[model samples]
Target: MFNVPMEVLFKVWRQKPHQSPQLQTYKLEVQAGNTILECLNRIKWEQDGSLAFRKNCRNTICGSCSMRINGRSALACKQNVGQELEMASSSNNGDVPTITIAPLGNMPVIKDLVVDMSGFWDKLQKVDPYVSTQGRKIPEREFLQTPEERSQLDQTGNCIMCGACYSECNALTVNPEFVGPHALAKAQRMVADSRDTEVEARLETYNQGTQGVWGCTRCYYCNAVCPMEVAPMDQIGYLKQDILDRKDAQSSRAIRHRKVLIDLVKQGGWIDERKFGVFVVGNYFRDLQGLLSLAPLGLRMLSSGKFPLSFEPSEGTKEVRSLIEAVQNHD
Candidate 1:
């Protein structure tokens, strides 16, 4: 089958540095097989010479043309005009199939479709994304990894640093300190490396307050929008489990929160709210500040008549316990 030529309406976001953005519309005659980058190139060359966007290699490998295509972050060089039209047809009931192109989210836009990625790079550095050679003797020869160890790095190794996952991360929207998914994904790569000598230290860094893995909201937007299928959210989960395995519950509030929640669920087939706060935030009456901090929330819950004074196990509590035990044993 041959790709037929069609006229498509392009709604492109236009903006100058430090200026408000606006959608500028253009009509282009394009072939269905033409990639979104190709269409943008033609538009810049023929329709509007002043139109601005970033491109290099005109291939997905460079990850230079990543943008919000039709409200989702993706690489323009990989998405074709036909796919956009089909997607629009399914979601849009308008007369014409329209493609809206805009710069990536959660970053400052430099121009029409170019975003400043300084924060993205900075967050990646915060995770110590590279292997550490500190405190290691000089290798006589090349340090080698077994096939299994090498394979563990395959998924994260594919990340092209496209910023697609970072643009769609919901956690970063509310918490700027939260290291974005792209960074966490790379952090997992470092953790999985056999040659890396800083596993314990890396876990400690990643477990530090909301600035690390604890901050992820697990909205899974990063997993959905990642063109390379890095599944950064899943990587975050791996990091969390690694921390849980190595550290005690009293190490931090986040660690206590997870351990306490699981223990409560196993005990009563649900969370015992009355004990949850005392154990997690209050640190089992060990931390005076933590205990005092829970007072206001506890009083508010009591006033609203939402506080659980008594605990009862749900039906099939044994079955739930068995399931939990099964999963723990499997892990």
Candidate 2:
């Protein structure tokens, strides 16, 4: 059998007593089949006894070995060094596959790979993740659900609390108060559960504040890094649809914003900035302070004769509206 020789370098985080973070490089000759987790274990056991990292079920299911590998969040146990090296070698950039293992971002680093999950746990607690019967006694028999009903909750329950989505999420980076993707996914799981009696209340909780679904920028980074394949962006979109269906009128800022943009596109086959700004920020007559804020920029555009009061309809406006109607009706 042909064996691949490995002499990879690991740029790992080193924590010393009463000091800030530091990166320490370690070189090792690993076998072809060795995983990143195995290499780290070898370094800890044979090379440096003080090296700190977490590994429980060596399998990917545990999610304990999540860290940044080659600038992407992935489970160390599942990552093959030889394959990563091969890809790096073939790339035009000639960037060698140097493993830069660090604690998952957006959470407090307790040690090396281990992050303090109190913040994550707290956000999850805020959502009240468990299904609430609300003063009802459970019967001896299990709750019966149709296959379709069961599938909705089952789709989101695959999340392993790995923090991969949290690390890649842009909303978490901008709004620290926003309940990150994992908590939202968990909330979505409960909201979709057929046995859950508090779907409306749960929906309200996710829509109430800035930390709610409105805060999500829909970057889809969470969908990419999720080990369980649960698309939090899709969950957020469904949550928005559910809220809109129920006519939760109070949370209509995003909806109004969306409608204004949609209507603009429908009328002209493109967005009308003047209308979008008026709708988004409110009417100019009603909100003088808001209109004044944009006065200078608006004047600059007016001076250039580019700021038209309204736009003529595009050639394909009717076709665009038909496409929109078709999609909604199909859904």
Candidate 3:
């Protein structure tokens, strides 16, 4: 932390309900020890009383201060002015260094640096984040879990529902029905709990449509911006693995896509684009509707000479197959 004060430019996104949003710049001389939240507080207290944002503990725990800082979602309370200035300097080409603050993405803004989290909460509810009702029946004492079982819940339990992961989720941006990473991370927590009797039901629900775990595009943006180091994308992967282990390819096109992708890779060390669509989306021509849905894309690919007519096995196919089999066996 620098004791010397430095003048930093803050470009904050300003929007009121039913108003066009724009950046409003604020100049402040701040010490490096001051957090982004502190600067925001100073701005509101001294510079602009009309400025709107949310805060609670003035620390990271409450997660109320989550917003975009320098183009990425994070908790403002956790970010120091020093770190942001250094980051801004690197990208600013020696121009005046500036920290850009905006409300979290993938949610509607209520005001400057504040977003409506109703959708975030609704998606979280869809995952049924609570432990199974059966497991919660009035017990004589606390429900117990082994050390190993408890360990599995540690990372996901760290989530404070800050909406950072939700803001960065690419799938949620395009597919409103897609439950964001925050929900799936919580779902994984419930699934990992030994006391949860609804394990199968939860897995089935998570495996269901684009709204569930299958919807994740694996962009890893959620993981990158998570404040608590929850690594939500990794939790989503665990959910997928659990479903893939129990469910067959015929369960759903999503399952088929995963199974076929792995099978093709095992056979040729990489996906066979030609066979992939047939087996996955088309379900080997068993589903006429699925086949019909592929017609437009198939015709376009063929017309553009982008369709592969033949398949060639990779030189390391045997090694790839062995590695996959080893993982399966270990599991």
Candidate 4:
């Protein structure tokens, strides 16, 4: 019960397309259980009529109210004023607590706290995230799945498409072509669905290059920012596993990366960095084209004094080998 209300200050980001961005502070008296969205509504309704933000479902399901609260991507509709105050206080050594609100990152801000999500949607489409069919005749009845197959869909099916994971994705920042985690997470739902018919074609499409699951840096920020605990990174991992199992494109660099990383880590305590590229990208220097493909980068590294000449076995090889063996055995 919010018997006593507290005055909280929100330093919200303000910007319009083709204009400068700034933080505008609004001090409001908010009740304890009031969500950050409620406080923003109060600010717009009472203090500032010109303020702008996006919201549809006041509940967390619609995911329209996703924004950065205290430098982390979260649903403003789900985070209460009390929790934000605690975070702000702890982060700044117990001074007057101030909430820092900003638009989600990695997308062009269209207006104050509103980002253009055309690219996000485009990437989702690139994955062909929907279930595919070859237009076969419909069954007499519904195409049903067993409980065991259905259970696999549970984790990824909760995605609300909030773009929180996309906002925080490090891989997308590095490679703009990389599909965001939201797409991959939803794509996995279709991948696991027993009713889907075109599983092989889907796997082949996703296995080609950095544009798919391979582009992920595995930073796990997508998992951390997700409000529904969809764990997009884990979903991407599942997609990777599926791709590997299907062997759709075994010669793909993504496959090579996984294969080489494991083999190298097993051989030495860690990646040698020297033999990694030669082994993975160069196909162990066996494929002349692969070796020639890396020639430019290797020459650049050599000229810049960055290329490594030799690598020795790591210090804790035995212990590392045992741990690797244990994990392999468990699997």
Better of 2 and 3 by TM-score: 3
Tens-digit per-residue lDDT, 176-232, candidate 2: 999888888888888888888999988878886569887889999899888779888
**TM-scores of the models, in the order given:** 0.92, 0.88, 0.94, 0.87
Cα deviation at 173, candidate 4, in Å, is 1.6
- List the global CA lDDT of all models: 0.90, 0.78, 0.90, 0.85
Best by lDDT: 3
Among residues 3 or more apart in sequence or in different chains, the pairs in candidate 3 whose N, CA or C atoms overlap within 3 Å are none
lDDT of 4 by residue, 185-295 (tens): 988888888878878888787766888888899998999999999999998888898777656324766787787887888898889898888887777777788888888
Query: Which 10 consecutive residues of model 1 have the lowest summed lDDT?
Result: 88-97
Q: Score candidate 1 by TM-score against the native.
A: 0.92
Candidate 4 wrong stretches, greater than 4 Å: 1-3, 89-95, 133-136, 248-250, 287-331
As for candidate 4, its clashing pairs are none
| Greater-TM-score candidate between 1 and 3 | 3
True-structure lDDT of candidate 2: 0.78
Provide the clash count, candidate 3: 0
lDDT (tens digit, per residue) of candidate 1 on 173-257: 9999999999999999999999898999999999989999999998989999898898999999999999999988878899999
- Which tens-of-lDDT digit does each residue in 30-100 have in candidate 3? 99988999999999999999999999998689999999999999999899988887776354524556788
Model 4 TM-score, all chains together? 0.87
If both were scored by TM-score, which would come out higher, candidate 1 or candidate 4?
Answer: 1
